[model samples]
Target: MAQKDGSTGSRERVLAAAAAMLAEDATAKLSVRAVAARAGVSTGSLRFHFPNQRALQDAVLARIYGHLFPDEQIHDRSLPARDRLVNCLRQALAPTGTGQQARETWTKAYRTYIASAPTEDVRAAYRAMDQAGRRRIEYWLTVLADEGALPKEDQASRVRFLSAVLDGLSIERALPTDESILRSETETLYTAVDCVLGGA
Candidate 1:
């Protein structure tokens, strides 16, 4: 544990230091001593905040998830459910073309998280996120079913399958910086929807 000379809680300071380290080195090299040094705190203070390595790792994982999939309000109700689904998929899978540096940083962070999977806390975080996504997918499937574009009884299966497809494609697209390949991935979402909905 470490204690900071300045107030504002040593745990927060330690988490901030860990996040900065990840930003710089692409993954958390979060030893208590290293984090304390970075935060200008004593090792005992760090322990007070996070009793063990796993506790610190859990915080880091939570921060990473927050950075990657931030909560945002979507206001556009005019678009069809299918179109909205496509739009969400595109935004999630494609780089927004803001700048190469920003995209590269995101790519690096994403890869690091992927490589460190199976942590219990991380798995729980993933499940919560996945459940939210599944709810949205089920909403879209219900809309399609109402329009006779999808079978009523197939809602769960279609949503599950589409969710899996989207998850796999996202992981694949994260592997490379090729814009063409990413574009292909976005297009594949449309194809997947078409196939799942019986190819209208």
Candidate 2:
């Protein structure tokens, strides 16, 4: 069932609907058939785009990040190591495709994960997205270590540690008050980043 509006195809509709579903449920009830129904397409059409759970997960992550930083310039690989980390965190805090650069998205994501405890597949999908974020962070961290900006002994652990902190902060993004409060939270995040990277 092709939608009347101008979407690319079943693929685009599926991803769009899936992302919205992920936003609302606070759990990963992201079954193929369910998503298909949400997209108003057949399961076959949905699978034609996603093929499998991991594929769908990857697409969801890609959709979120891609929309957040469509013209990404920090991934040039030639920029300074510190700049990469800054850019990485910048993207992390950016508003999503729907201009939700605030904390509500984090609340929804947390809710989704809480709801996902009963389903290993949904849990794995969440972990996959988290790992994807970690991998991006790791790339910049590795560059920093290579440039001698970060410690070499525990690079892997360092990335994981920082990623965990950042991810947690991301969840608390919507918990701030006024502008001053937001600034305070932002400073806390920067401090955590500094703590993780061992200060620049």
Candidate 3:
């Protein structure tokens, strides 16, 4: 019993350490050695809990999503499905602030993942983040579909389209745009939602 409790505690600590590393630097490589060092645990212990880098990354992403989204708004049946989805997507974008902050965010992203060839670890980190985003969108769409508010077919295409719209809007946020950009972004979001839900 004591051994089991200790193992659970070690797992929690490792996950917390990994999450902290990601919070500090979004592109940080979550290698077993690094995470274990951060957690003050042995590499064997981390591997016992997480098995691999992908497993650790997925667990951390799931934890972050649970804290950020919480499913309350997504499952709120009072609001229209489109509204719930749009709000969720907006929540994802809220981190990329407007004006200067957004510009800095974009600059960092470009330097980290776009300007030059990324290492294997960097590529894996980016892919994990991207997959997590897609999974979150797919989960929201699935809930709406289950509620009979959205079509169940072509979910992959719908998620991809919405994600593309979001990527474009995020880039727009960083650009030297006018004040009406926010309003325009919201309108674009609504249109995207309508297109997906309406199956257009």
Best by TM-score: 3
Lowest lDDT sum, 10 consecutive residues, model 2, at 95-104
RMSD of 1: 13.4
Better of 1 and 2 by lDDT: 2
Clashing pairs in 2: 26-111, 26-112, 27-112, 95-101, 103-174
Q: In candidate 1, what residue range of length 10 has the lowest lDDT sum?
A: 68-77
* Tens digits of per-residue lDDT for model 2, 59-143: 7756765676666544456775555676667666565311245555765776788755748877776767776576566555554
Q: Is candidate 1 or candidate 3 better by lDDT?
A: 3
Better of 1 and 3 by TM-score: 3
Would you list the rank order by TM-score, best first?
Answer: 3, 2, 1
How far residue 145's Cα lies from its native spot in candidate 2, in Å, is 1.4
**Cα-lDDT of candidate 1:** 0.64
RMSD of each: 13.4, 10.9, 7.0
Model 3 / residue 164 / CA error / Å = 0.6
Clashes of each: 12, 5, 0
| CA-lDDT, candidates in order | 0.64, 0.66, 0.83
Please, what is the TM-score per model?
Answer: 0.46, 0.52, 0.66
Stretches off by above 4 angstroms in model 3 are: 1-68
TM-score of 3: 0.66
* Candidate 1 to truth, TM: 0.46
Higher-ranked by TM-score: 1 or 2: 2
